[model samples]
Target chain A: MQDLLFYFFAVLTLIFGFLVVVNPFTRSPVTSAMFLVLSIISMSGLFVMLHAFFLAAIQILVYSGAVIVLFLFVIMLMDLKEEARSTFQGIRLTFSLLLAGLFATVLIGVVLTSGLGAEPVVLTLEGSTAVLGERLFNAYIIPFEILSVLLLVGMVGVVLLSKKNLN
Target chain B: MVGLEHYLVVSILLFSIGALGVMLRRNLLVIYMGLEMMLNAANLALVAFSRFNDNINGQILVFFIITVAAAEVAVGLALIVALYRRRRTTDVRELTDLKL
Candidate 1:
């Protein structure tokens, strides 16, 4: 049951994802952006199936709900063109496809060969959350703090980039 | 068998698609969206791994990742806007002024 739904949504998400990447040629960023939002929502459903309930909610709320809206807004504001003369043309396209294929094959091979024969060490739902919280607030505290700094830097950079330089 | 490995394979395919998008697209915004796709692909892998390993750490890391990704998109779009304002184009071809 769960597996069936997972496959269904995964296929849906993949289709929309394909649409998004090919969207530049469609001459409508708005349509691409809408498909992207739908894809994100479908991914959130996958998260729920994984039993990461909190993460699922956050995925929908943050990604599908907020970030996508921002993307749509940006798409609306920008004056998109046909983009016929791009710097990254034929050879680059072929090379990228090749590189992506190589890396994906290698990673997939490694994962498959590893043989996940050992039964998973299941942690209780409540206990798992508690441990996660502890690690975030304690062991990974520095990265947490650094993430905040990163946000600050991004904020400052955006402001500086947007603001008119009074020369 | 449609188990954890199946999910991982699907996730890998998605990541590859994103990689292709980033590699081929000349538009910075499209590249950024490709980057987002890669991130989401990894997030799916993380959650799937967490479920298989019966750990929640992956999910928590995913939480932090999402936060950072949101911030990234925010700033990236802003930079695109600023770049557009100065150059009137978002094509990477026209960005040669700074490269030279």
Candidate 2:
């Protein structure tokens, strides 16, 4: 049962992720963004399968909920027209696809030959929310604080950049 | 039985797809989305390793990564919007002010 779920989510993640990148049926960025949301949701399902339940919830809450919504808002705000179908052509398209395929083949080959044994470790500690919260506030506290500061800077930078007339 | 290798393979494929999107697409927004996908791919790998290793640090790192990604998207989208206001196009090929 678990194996079947894993395969289902993995395939869905790959399919939707591919559509997010290259949907032959639609040239609209909105369509891509929606597909990305589907991809992210399926990925979170993988997270759940891994027993990182907290991360799975956070993935849905932050990624599919907040991040993709932001993407849609920007897409709508720009009112972008459908991209030209001829944008990708000739040598550039071939080169990029070739490069990406080469990258995948090399990485997968390395992974297969690395000889890492596949014995699933009995998880002594599940990534429950309470434990994650404790770790976040305890051992990882400094990085946690730094992340907040980084977010503050990002928010201020975004506001300044988006202003109508920045001198 | 899905093992560590299976998860890693999925991660590799997703990362490659993201890279393909980044290199092949013209729209800056789409490219940005591709970048997000790449980051998520890394996150997926980290989570898998964390699980198989019986470590919590990986999940903690993923939490930080998620926060950083949110910040990145906010700032990145704002920059794209500002650029569109001035340049009126999101196509990457045309925004070549730095081309010498």
Candidate 3:
């Protein structure tokens, strides 16, 4: 039941994540952004299976919803050259791929050796929103307030930076 | 057979794919998306570990991470837009005028 759902979403996550990186058809960022949508949505699914329902909704709302739309808007805003959009053309391609491979090997090896997947412990708590909110508003209240301020600062900074010169 | 390690494997692969995109892709937008992918990979691992460990803190951390990421993208895209306005190109290679 849950195992099958896990595999399904896991496979989808990897496939779309790969496509976001190295899609063979077109090098357009728009296509990559679409694939990113698939990847994020599946990731939220994994979160749900893990019983982090609140975070799962946030993942969908904040990530797949707001973040991806922002990416798409920027893609449409940018004027890209079709001929210049192609990636991995010459020697750098091979070198980059090699490095990427080496990185994957090292991390995957560590994760495999750790045997984390061997122990399938059943969870006692569902990690529901109310529980999360209790902890958040109690112990994590200060940081939560600070985060709001940070978001506000970021909004102001972006507007000022992107605005055309007034003087 | 799915377990914590299985989820970790998927997360790690996701991170690797993102790293490749960042290294190989020329388009700035793709690079940005790759960075986001890497962030997401981290988020996935956090949630998985939190789940298996029977904790909620990891999810809260992921919450902060996503918030920060949204702010980051806003600023980063704004910078990219400003740069594009001045140079009219999104290729990183051509934007190396500061290179001495």
For residue B33, what is the lDDT in candidate 2? 88
lDDT of 1 by residue, A1-167 (tens): 87799899899888888777776456456676787788888888887777777787788899888888888888778778766645445788779879999989998998788876345455444324566668789888998999999989988887777787624
lDDT of 3 by residue, A1-167 (tens): 98999999999999999999887778778889999999999988998888889988998999889888988888788778763544468888899889988988898899889777676677776768999899989999999999999999999998898788834
Model 2, first chain, TM-score of 0.95
The DockQ scores of all candidates, in the order shown, are 0.57, 0.84, 0.81
Give the top-scoring candidate (TM-score). 2
What would the per-residue lDDT of candidate 3 be over residues B1-100, giving only the tens digit for each residue?
A: 6778888888888998999999988778888999999999999999888888888899889889999999999899988888888999888888887899
Using TM-score, rank the candidates from best to worst. Answer: 2, 3, 1
Tell me the docking grade of candidate 3.
high
How many clashing residue pairs appear in each of the predictions shown?
A: 0, 0, 1
Ten-residue stretch with the least lDDT total in model 1 chain A: A119-128
Task: Output the lDDT of residue A149, model 2.
Answer: 97
lDDT of each: 0.80, 0.93, 0.87
How high is the lDDT of residue A93 in model 2? 92
Q: List the residue pairs that clash in candidate 3.
A: A117-B5
